[model samples]
Target: MDAEHIRAIAQQTGCTHIHPGYGFLSESPQLASLFPEGGAIVFIGPSTGTLRVASDKMQSRALAVHNGVPVAPGAHVSSAEDVHKFVEGLGSAPFPIIIKALDGGGGRGIRLVYAEDHIDHAFRRCVGESASRRVFAEKAFVGPGWRHVEVQIVGDGLGNVSHLWERECSVQRRFQKVVEMAPSTLPRDTVGHVIEAALKMARHLQYKSLGTFEFLIDDHAKHWIFLEINPRIQVEHTVTEELLNIDLVKAQLQLSLPKASLEVVLPAWTMSPQPSPPPGYAIQLRLVAEDPHKDFRLSTGTIGPADVFWPSGRGVRVDTWLSTGPYYRGGLQWAVGVDFDSLLAKIVVHAGTFQEASARALRALRETRIAGDVKTNVEILSGVIAHQDWSSGRIYTQWLEEKVDQLVQLGNTQLTRQSRGSLSDTAAPRRLSGGTESATATALLQPGASFQLSLSPSLPQAASGQQTQKHTLVISSIGRNAFPNELSGTITTSLSAMPLSFSLSQLSSIMASAHTEFANPADPSHVASPIAGKIVELHPALETVAGDANKGSYVRKGEPLVVISVMKMESVVNAPASGRVVRVGRGIEVGNIVAEGALLCVLDVTDMDKGLARL
Candidate 1:
């Protein structure tokens, strides 16, 4: 919530407490100072000193090291020159070190350096990123394998704290965790050690409110090392809640003040481990606002006109800020108009075991769709779900980076097929009527004339490589008053009529054995707006086509018809080909869904004899 808006509401409702829920101003020292002087609002969190201690990575590391917590061997370099000095001292250090930002939130200001060549570049990048994002840097940890485990503990404002087990956050993309599960795949004894260490760290710092102690578990050695302590609620809090059955939020709100200890019993301390394992599995995939095809490029803006199918079962929960309808579009795209936002819709699942829960989550994601100019990363997510490495729990942090190429190809292929408007397997096209009219052997005819024309072969062959097929039309005077000397009503023709182009839609219908009409391009009729996007603007049209070509204008195929812009990118409307307009609507403009082949304007190319003879 906006601070000012919350303050306004606080004044109206006479509310006394303002609890900042993690991130932003939640951990700010100045907020605590400012709120009290205002007289009404009381900020609920740790004091200014606790925040200051927890905010700096170097200080936290030193504190943890002093308390007998195992930590990675990395030096904090204040400048590029300092990095060189640190590098010199480390004569035989291993490659592929992680450089982290001191003040970075999330994984934004981190870099993984592989070799000596990358050292300088990595240092420079981290320095710039940290400075700009207000983060600091740390050297990477080299181990056989690495697993991220986090322990959650809440203080009673006095001193007592309770543990809420640990969450395994090993699965990642670009160093950012995408999937997290409670009760890591680590051994029971290992978990117990980590939990005990976390409590010690918490007690040492006298931590208060909801906090998580992070650790990097060594792959081969089975050793856990303290990384840092997040003195606020984490994004993966739901996972802890699922396994522990504890509402950290409610607990935080209730025990925020400097109150005495409560006698309430917490939920079952930790997840129970079977002698073998659980009956099923639970896996979660983070649905970020990104295009997985484009190297997982952050797709900023309203992510969807989507439907939220809440995954249900004994262990399914969707913690999202969206609901049914277009209102729930994700991501707050700043450049475009308002109505943009992204969320960490924590979709959780519980089953007899891990495999079942993973299956359920996969199925739920497959059923999801976003109806708008925005596209989703569904394909990549699905790929990850089906990946053997992921299924077997053999995934690493570099998994996504390795599979980026294949995922990009697959996603792009899907987009190409979707854009072509090929709704089905059949690629054949239908034909339209009134191709051409023959010249009369006797009298001259004006260009503006509507004639009922017949075709020798009503349907034309499929359009092949820009080579157009011709239709022979026979046209004659309808009444004796119209043509006095014409033989009967239909005049015998020696020459064939000019050819009229049939659009993809018309060809489709004819191929499907449907009745046909003449090709009329001028029908400013709307068709199904094939692709989905926001309508930006419609160009001013000066000409309108009527059914009769001689009396009205004709629109050529591939001519600009309408435009729909998706995600701020513009797309144009076009005429299929040269055909007479039958009925163009005046109100047809931007934001209108022109159903496939809906008539635009009416046009009659009846002077086929004159035009065809020329052809």
Candidate 2:
């Protein structure tokens, strides 16, 4: 949204074109208008008018309604009273009402209000999250099998538009898409209606460049509601491109030409009488750097090039910003820090059938190996693809959340099975593949670091009342790297003469535990921040809990205490147990950055039942 800075840079560098590739200023009408028509520079995106209308959720909903498209029951709301009235108007339609920002996307600035008391908090959070300070209330379409579908469309400034097809994005976490597949599993006729609806809106507005028309389908697949239009390319655009064998970014550039048209930009589609479904199936998985075991908390650390491995083949494609060059300070090492998106890369696979695609995706995930202190969603992605429900297409937006525990267990079991026989019987350290010896040495034993290695007999030992032998290894020095895979190091170890053996996985586990143990707070009374992020809002009841004389506020277990915003997602920190807040951490307030493991508050558990408090 910093149009002036971008303009100044473009002018200084003598650049003639600016392509806002999704996010940030991609949907900013003000940014698009900065480079006027016939100017020295051109904005490779929709015109200012189209951006203004499409970026506003309320205006887009009104446009959908005017064009005879169905939209959920909703109204512009500025206060809790307006939200209550909107809910009253719905009557018995639905219990949970959704509060959303008027101009938010990518699942941010949204809250689900399930009761009247939560309306005010959700409303205030939405207002604070939105840049416009505007919000809306709508009846939520709670479903056991609801699906999120979107149509890919491209148009020129002259009102000519082409529908590229639709994508099924039902697999999501916290309203953010996790997996997307091209050519929805819905019936042909149902998809046809959605495509036509998208084209109608795009043609009416003469929408130029690429955009997405999002919709929510009911469980029965018999009804759908217009959600909103994303007036820019999305993260899932790779799914559509892989399915159709076309370059969407190239197409966007071609359409921005002075005299571009559908016939010139896409001759293959113009020659056909109607838009035909592309052959084959393509699935894209969003590989994020997060820990599913910790409620998808963002994982931050330096991931060396030798610490990770990527899958590649004929039909598999991995798109990421990771590289191994001196241009970056870390040189191919992923320095995943806080205050940024958790997305690491997108792994896309294409096959002749859905089953084949799923199988290939599983194989690719199994081949992926990420080590060191960083964590990823690769295991969770594998679990989802291998689930029976996923294979049978019985999924919805909330399905992952409901089955996360089961899926995590399944993924762990699969991993265990894969590594069952990986250890060798020989009493020697095995060399790990895809990693330099120096890098491996650096990972296992840094200079002056001490580690313990337990040694067990390679063969059955005689029954004895003695403890197993242990070795204390200390790293003395790590000489300069003279070769890529050569390392000179001295490991002073106290070892006994015995047939002993250990595996590489054991060493890796020790290294990981040593690095991450500090992030887990030891004191139970201290409420620690789960991840590094900014505290956006503090609980109202916490005001009186800051003093010693007040006795603080009595909060029950699972009650919210603070809301933290990180990586464009909001996470609520709830009370761990029934207790009174006796102290708030110094400098912990709204808009304050809180580090992981930093104390947020202190809880007084005098009134909490012992049994209840343990929970």
Candidate 3:
């Protein structure tokens, strides 16, 4: 919400009460305090002191340990001496120790201590980060495996508290939860113990309002430790809402209002009441602008030609901040600006089975086209869906690490197919007569060599440092795409054969001759557009750079003809190796499209003083 609009709304609505969702203004006691003073709104949350206490990672860990809640072993250090003091005691704990910034969470201020020698470097880095982000450190949670379990609780104004069932949020990437579902995969007794600890913590602080206590469950399922508590609504709150018919937001408002009466509608919380896994399964894939496979850095800019078709049959919900119209109705127009671009557009899908839902969502995501500088990690998410581990429900917090290469390949493949308009047609392997293959090979290469050959700008060399420069380029079996394992030995070249097996290096290095025919050739000024789109820039050099044809006002063929951009692909057309500038036109941008050989700019291939020969 914008500033002016929010203020106007506050004025009109009388600002009786405000409940900022989690990660927003939810835990801001200072902002909450402003409500009562302004005599307009009331902030619904705990006291300012409690907010400070919960926000501090070290302080919270100490509290949890003091209250008999198990926590990972580690001491909060402030400087180098503090680290020296604690390092001696960390006997046999393993190599990868975690050093997290006290004030930071959500995987931002965290580093892995890979080796003993790296501890000092890791410690110093964390200290600097802590000072900057106002955080401290504790022993990182290193175990066989980690499971994120969260419990949502509501407190009555009179100090009565109740715990809703816990949700297992173990599926993650970059420490951010991607998929969360109700009824944790942990044991029933473990869930009870965590809930008991959570209630104790809440009572100790007298926290009144909606809150969630987080815990890290180790691999053995024998040990569960309290991590900390999120003082506001989380992004995954929908998971709990889906499992339980209760609206947590409404409950929070009622509980915060002192005069509002309370009702015991939900029965005393029981573990078995989690609704038997909801019949089918549901998964929410966060459509983040930033690439998870690419360091998770913030990727900003507009998403053009944005159009979304929601699945409305049933069991599907789309929570997004996207719209369309003349502003973005055209095929490749920008929808959002650079700012507010990094946020996600979440797609919640549900089906009778996990596989079905995942497949449906994948299809929907790929079919829709969202162009512009703002790139989404839709390809990565699809890869996860297709992965055997993910599809089989064996996903873990670090699953993405093992599948990084696969994700990158999938992303690049999608981008290439989309750009080239090759996504539509899936061709079958063509079968050529043995004689035909032999004849084509003999025709296109030197004596005894098989196939036509042209090297691209980049010639790929093998690990042996040997660059193959022959008609039938040789490649390792692995580099050849879709070739049968049996034929990987030595498949002779065949130019006429379709779906030919070639290495990526081979394809990229295949360049047509400079004099390759363009069907209807023209002079420098007669030469057409560079890109496959409408004109965008026509340099003034058409006359000066290409001299004059008749009265020196004419262009001396063979120069930068013109610039055009189609489907976002841009290039400047120069004389077909050499030509003269004849005609120049207006500029073009994002929305225009051009045919194979449409006359965009004209060039004259004539001999002049400033022509190719002159150079």
Report the lDDT tens digits of candidate 1 across residue range 1-615.
355666678778988887877655575555555566236666676656667667667777888888898877767776656656666665686555666677655664577777666666556445544533333344465433667888887776556666777787776765677778766767767777778888887777676677888888775677668888777888788776665556777777766554534345343323223222223444555665555644443343232212223445567777765454477334332121211233426677655556666666666664444422223566666566556665676655566667766654553444343334422222212111322211111233322222223233223543232344323222333344333123343335433344333211111111111121233332334333333334444423314332222454445555555554433223455654455444554334455432222233433345334433433
**Candidate 3, position 289, lDDT:** 63
Candidate 3 lDDT, 1-615, residue by residue in tens:
343455458779887776666653565555555555236666677656667777777778877988999887777776656665565676765445577776555554566666666666556545544434343434566433667788887665445566776777776665667666565655677677788888888877777777889998775656778887778777776656654556777777766665543354343443332332334455666777654544543343333222233333455566765545445444442333222334456666656565676675665555544433345777776666666666655655566655667865775564344344423322211223221111011112121211222322232233234332323333322433332111234445443322333321111111112211122332334343322334444455553433443422233334444544322223445545444444432222223333223344444444454654444
lDDT scores of the candidates, listed in order: 0.54, 0.76, 0.53
- The TM-scores of all predictions, comma-separated, are 0.60, 0.82, 0.59
lDDT of 2 at 559: 82
Worst 10 residues of 3 by lDDT: 435-444
> Over the stretch 585-612, how does candidate 2's per-residue lDDT look in tens digits?
7656787666555567888777566435
Model 2 pairs in collision: none
Model 2 segments more than 4 A misplaced: 219-221, 325-332, 414-522, 539-560, 577-580, 586-590, 607-615
Candidate 1: worst-modelled 10 consecutive residues by lDDT: 504-513
In lDDT terms, how accurate is model 1? 0.54
RMSD of each: 17.6, 6.9, 16.9
After superposing candidate 3, which stretches have Cα over 4 Å from the reference? 1-14, 36-40, 116-133, 186-189, 261-280, 292-296, 305-312, 324-341, 351-369, 407-615
| lDDT of candidate model 3 versus the reference | 0.53
Cα deviation at 519, candidate 2, in Å, is: 9.3
Q: Number of the top candidate by TM-score? A: 2
Which prediction has more favorable lDDT, 2 or 3?
2
